[model samples]
Target chain A: MVLVALLTGGLFLPQWAMFIVTIAFAKALVALGLMILLRAGLISFGQALYYCLGAYAAGALGRFLGIADIFVQMLAGAAAAGIAAFILGFLLAKYRGIFFGLLSLALSMILYGLLVKNETLGSTDGFNILPSTLFGTRPGPAWVRYAVLASAAVVSLGLALVVHRYLRTPLGRLAPAIKDNEIRVEYMGASARYAVHVIYVVAAVLAGVGGALAATTVGHIDPDMAFWTTSGEFIFITILAGTGSVVAPFAGALIYEIIHTTAYDLSPNTWQLSLGAALLIIIVFLPQGLWSLVSKMSTRYARHP
Target chain B: MRKVLVALAVAAAMPAAHAQSVKIGVVTFLSGPAAAPFGVPAKNSAEFVVEQLNNGQAPAPYSKKGFGGAPLEIVLLDEAGSTTTQVTEFRNLVQRQNVDLIIGYVSSGNCLAIAPVAEELKKLTNFFDCGTPRIFEDASYEYVFRTSPTATMDSVGAALYVKDAKPGVKSIAGLNQNYAWGQDSWGDFEATMKVLVPSLDVKTSQMPKLFAGQYNAEISALLSAKPDVIHSSFWDGDLEAFILQAGPRGLMKQSLTILTTGETAMHKLGKQIPDGTVLGARGPFGPYAPNNQYNKWFHGGFVAKYKDEPNYASYQMAQAFLGVKAAWEKAQDANGGKRPSNEQVAAALKGSTFEGPGGTVKMSIGKGHQAVMETAYGVTKLQGGKLTVTNVKRYPAEKVNPPEGVKSADWIKGGFKAQ
Candidate 1:
């Protein structure tokens, strides 16, 4: 039903709203990567490392290599980011909490440094990619936007379902167990570190795919994609969404973009203040995040009905 | 009832005559790292020119009775956040706000992102002050045109000034923002300087991160390399920060610093610019612009309103506004006492030349729908407790600017037209 609405009802939205929702969906995909790890009680502050990789990879494919097919670029982006994560996961899974966060951050910063210094990839300014295409045919920007929107809706929903199923599996059930008591999980003959490594790789691929979609939608990418602040934003959305379900990050991402764009429109100079205050209110009132509120309201409605 | 219906239909038909102002969406950074120099000054200039046009106060040519008799209704949009956000905002400006035209962006990336979208939306656009040659070089658009020269022009002008003024200079060093804009400017400057003076040896080059705004290490490296000259294309807070740090360190005492697009921060730097430093205004911009009536009106009008001498961004804004107004007037003339469609305005802008505040800003039809204009060069000298650009010289556009589709590096390497 949500995918149907995204395809059908999304068409009726004003151009700005459609574009806004597209951006929201892109960010949500990245936030979902965080949401996966948050369920395991792990945080990656350098998610931008994968995000930038996805973006640059997709950008290079379209801009330099002349592959405008959206699916091919997205797959290429995901593969490149996944490979990087697979290599880095060994060192990362051994650590937890702040060590993990800081290490991820350091890794992302290294990418940022390399990108900023290299002029061929456009350095800080970055470069533009080819206009988005459906299969092999070039479409107008609006149609391309619609195509991205539909893809985002379907892919996010599929990822959510897959993640939901993963949670019920033996490996999936070990996530929360590892978070609660890693030593106990290890005592049960499971390597808690190996489980984390799997989760880490999963999140990395998700972030890469998200970055690819975002670059195609925006039609540009820069070192800013790999900047630590961008990673922080993903984390912000993860917190706002809560770890309740695979779908919360989608809602959180939408609300964040709406509030952010509106705040900036309302007060261009003091928008950051508005964003901070909103986050503060969310923390104080709904600590588990906007998703928890939804569950509460649904429960109340069901009982009354 | 029949007569009333006829009157209503006439009123609706001739909306332009009944004072429906030409709505323009102006996009500039109201708050960002670039706000100080590139954004605020540009916004102020646009506001000032629009007010003058609406009121029928600016001098001749620009004094064309409110955008060909349709007063401008201005909407200012803040350009901040990622390029995607800007692309969304641009669509909002066109689809949601129903702005007839858009003028925007200080970042080259923003301009490049918006250009294709603007063309897709079929909205007439004026990219006010972003300096990337890649915009036109990469693609051609019927609806998009930059009224000012790109970074290549500014870098070339700086190189020309250095060759003419600092005849004794042998070794050169570059300190530019590490981005496409910075690198492109360096490539053009380094290549052009080598052509102008073959013996000019490169001692050291630094590509600092954009908006890093701290240059202690970059400054130390420059001091150690000890080139006879240092060329930079830094702008906004970064340039101000560099001057603040490098000025006190006596780096200026060792080598003459050449600031490409330097005039934007003249007021902030003033005496701190150092006496022997060379600078270019990106074009015939700022106080160093040609002494013409259009410039006199602009300089005097801006100072009277803002209580500050107009910076390079201000002059460029004025020039863009003037170009837009001139196009509108030509469209109006073509239509014969009526409002022309956005397409007509774009058509009029093509291959048209209009007198800018500094000099003539003209479009070459064969040149990938891009505009080119002459550039102004100056040397900073401390006098009367402030830095003033002296020994100012203006170079012809055809001489300094590379032709359409020719990479600036290739052009400089090819000896700038002939042996």
Candidate 2:
């Protein structure tokens, strides 16, 4: 059934429909990273900084550095984000809870300020992503588009399997332990900082992947990717998914895209109100997120089985 | 934070000698996602205008005689469009600086938020470029007038051009920013297109969240829609991204792209934009056909100053200062030449027809006191190794604007009354 749905999604969607799906998928990738950080009791409100780092690296590489190979660009983006995460993660990993959130936010804002002030990277105006090439051929847009969707699907599925596998591992289980009782983990002679740093680097790499995917899809990057509110949006998407699974963030992202597109289309002026109302309703009723409902239904069926 | 506070404090420390310098408060978005495109140009234009004003050559009609011997000084206040920041800046401008006149604010939300305060304080407001039709839906403010065309005028005019020029256009794919101006532009354009061409089909419309600069998914969907025509009102970074991605992929080649706010980018990305593409401005560009005498004069002076042709935005700013000058002059003429009071100047601005660079504009008070003005249309082309628009046409404001009794916010709240 799931294969049928995935196949249907792959084959049936019109071009624009697939595009929306890919965007949702990219957003979900970033949101999943936020979910991992949150699982470790670290609420990151600066994911956009890493996202921007990845996107800028991809955009700059693709446009200026003449590296149009999608994989290389994506890898460069991930490596760039991972490097920054490694440095900032060392400082940020020591902090927990709200302090972690604020520090991350501050770090992202600082990047935003730098990007805005520097005219060479197009400053506040932002730079465009050069056309991405597939293999050695300049593929047509539809081909490139389908490739994006396929990439999103593969990445998402891989992440889902990886995250589920992670939960079964000692490190993954220990992450939640740190969330619940950090002192107890410290008493167990495990360095929580190291675990946090690893998770931070992992999440940053994921965010870099998301940014690279975004650059490929949008063919542009801007300082807005590093803005504080953008980071908040990543956190919001993560919270909306209830940390249920890697796929949940993707589901939440799809829902967000649909709602956002519909609201803006109906009335661009009043759509903000619609988004606020939706967020309010979602917060009030389904506090655990839409994925929580899906998980509950599946659990009930599994128990009966 | 300290630097920002210090700047605010410095603005606060300006002397209250109202009779000396002609203090004008200008508000615009200086932070957040939208600033790169809209705010920067607005500030630059204002600075350029002030430099012109201070340089003793006030263009043609804007002689030094307009300022009554007091040099024009601008106190720039950043509204940034968020209500929280807008309110704070509004208080600071009014209470601390005690500006003589207020201008600026490009976002509809900021304009709607601050317009009421201007009305309450009876401060003369010269709106440059807030395009939410809701502003003019209410009763016209005596103290408020906009120099830029309303969003409806811009969109409806483009619709007319599209219907005539690209008669074979069927399916339309739309991408607009998620905001009031974006909504009104989409609504008016769709409505106008439907009215003119009954068989016109809207294939897919996407209003992605505002400032959601990442749009490959939406782009894919939009391209998939296979529309004959695509229209977008995405400004600044969003617009740049859309163009860069869509242009090389033959999206521009396949679709009849109608860019409502492409003027800001035409010079920068001229070659990338496909020929035969339809572009329009919120107000008339200097090169727009149906050239009136005012356009010639405005064009000549603008070229003389900037060494480049005046885009619609620059022309709009010029017209705004012209409107303010006209109102003050009319008031002074009525008040026996001693400089008009704020109320008098406001009354002069309301319901009064004034000749501007874009042609003649009249204020009709609607919901939010929006301004309805002429629209310009053109075809994109590369000229002299630079992006130069050609085949430019100008439609009178009356043809595209809502009929006088339509009660649209742009028509209702915006009116001019020459005292």
Candidate 3:
């Protein structure tokens, strides 16, 4: 991936490569947020709500205070989104599976309706984002591209290591056990609600980070960031990557970006058909996704030895 | 029980006192991703206009002459995103508040749905910003009037611009939002292009569902089509997203990029737009070119009051108000300075020319009481990093109107000649 990035450097390749890479990174961050919830056996369809929450927070603060610092805006957004998740998460952690998903979706839609109804947030015309400055200086195009790439890489690598370390802990094992048999975990003296709430809040923060990054990349925000369709997209990312590793979301996001770019270029009208067909093929042939296919193939080769 | 009933009957029999302020209903999408560029501006314009209207300045173009000799009041309503919601809200506005007229409905779907309800309730409506030709094509109700041109009119202007500006252009491709406006725009442009430029080949046509946000795939396909020109009718965030993605990709650099609704995004894109890209307003450009007297009047007054240049949305809203004002003046003149009845006001609105900020618009009463208006085209460029439009051209409304009493053919059949 690093080598490919180097090859597609702004000096050599089309500028779109870097932009696509930046978007892929941001999407991976959002997908990673979903992975955290999936780890706790909680399905969330309101990730978009957190995404919008983070984006709007950043945009509003950036515009209102004349603070164009990317890091400061991101921090403000993450903090706001975290607070929102903590409050909304309390009610959300009680539900599980499809119920959890549906409830989250309903809550997000309610917020969507509010933003749409309120003229303060620009209603549907969307809020224009101030051009982000890193620290006190405005970065050039090359620097912005590099900064975005580095952010993606750091988030992906950092989150994967964190998730990997987390799974080694007894508490982390309890998450899946609670998913499998909550009664057994309860007998083991675990509070399922607290564990799930922690997971939800953590996932929201990660999604918030992703949303902030995406806002910087796209340079705008609107209520659609909190829509059910966007939440469904996160779920789609999860399903495409499977729940094996933290890296799965990043991988899936990359593949999805590639597919999106290529399919749109192939037949703009029929591109959706191409995307749907590809997803269908993946579901039918490799239910475990491309990553697991690699894992399965490696195991098969090792068995021959 | 009899005494209570008698008291209730007496209370109901007393006529409800009218508020000192004139109430105008403002409807548009207020929530969701699509609201940012479209709904927010619409609501802001309504607030700004109402504030100015009541401020006692009685601004030159929108002077206090229309409100039945009273101050005007705007009652805002959120259309959300459904026809059912619009219908219910329209009913509530007419039956409950007893508003004399309504002034806003941004989406064509919402306008089409609520227009009949306005007709049924005998309410006067100034349909602003809704551009679906279907709204005008399917009915002949007497109450509905649109201040803005339909998609058919606007798209035809775009086609004319392309022909005049890029005469050598052929193999055209399009990317539009998947809805009534988008569909009609591409359909109109293609048919008109075919009729005018015989050699023009339609290499690609794509409709991305509105608010898709991600445009990589479609962009790639459009780039590959390798057309000499590309036209898009994406509005609000859809346009923003497409431009953001395509700007860096050099798609705009490759083709004669024609944004049918580009004037709306001028403030946002500012100077980021590729030079020489053809852009235009769906109706009239807010900043009229030299020689348009009404444009000069509207622009000067709006800027003086608002302290900002009027956007296309604001212009469209002001046009609606202007239409109402014209109808009111005509009714007053005909009625010997007496306030005309609802029927008379409706008649004045239909088949009358109202001077708009862009230019004068003649409202043609269509099959569904759709008020079709004139169109304007322009060229876009980034001047000091803000989107700037130039070379505005005015097209008469009748040239783009579908043959009267006939539903629009799914495909337009014609040959093109260089206009």
Candidate of highest DockQ? 1
TM-score of structure candidate 1: 0.94
Clash count list over all predictions: 0, 47, 31
lDDT (Cα, tens digit) per residue for candidate 3, span A1-305? 64355444534433345556666777777787787777778888888888888888888877788876777766776787799989987898788989998998998888787776554564544555666787688777546645555554555566667767877777677788878898888888988888888778778877787778777655656676787988887888888888777778888887877776565445433556787898888878879765797678789999997
Candidate 1 off by > 4 Å: A140-142, A302-305, B1-19, B211-214, B365-368
Local accuracy by lDDT, each model: 0.84, 0.71, 0.71
- Winner on lDDT (1 vs 3): 1
**Best of the candidates, lDDT:** 1
Top-down lDDT ranking: 1, 2, 3
Which candidate would rank higher by DockQ, 1 or 2? 1
DockQ, all models: 0.60, 0.02, 0.01
Q: Per-residue alpha-carbon lDDT of model 3 for B257-326, expressed as tens digits?
A: 9987777777767666778877777676664433465566556666775677767777777667767876
Q: Rank the candidates by TM-score, best first.
A: 1, 2, 3
Question: Worst ten-residue run, lDDT, model 1 chain A?
Answer: A262-271
* Model 1 C-alpha lDDT per residue in residues A14-39, reported as the tens digit of each score: 77787788778778888988987877
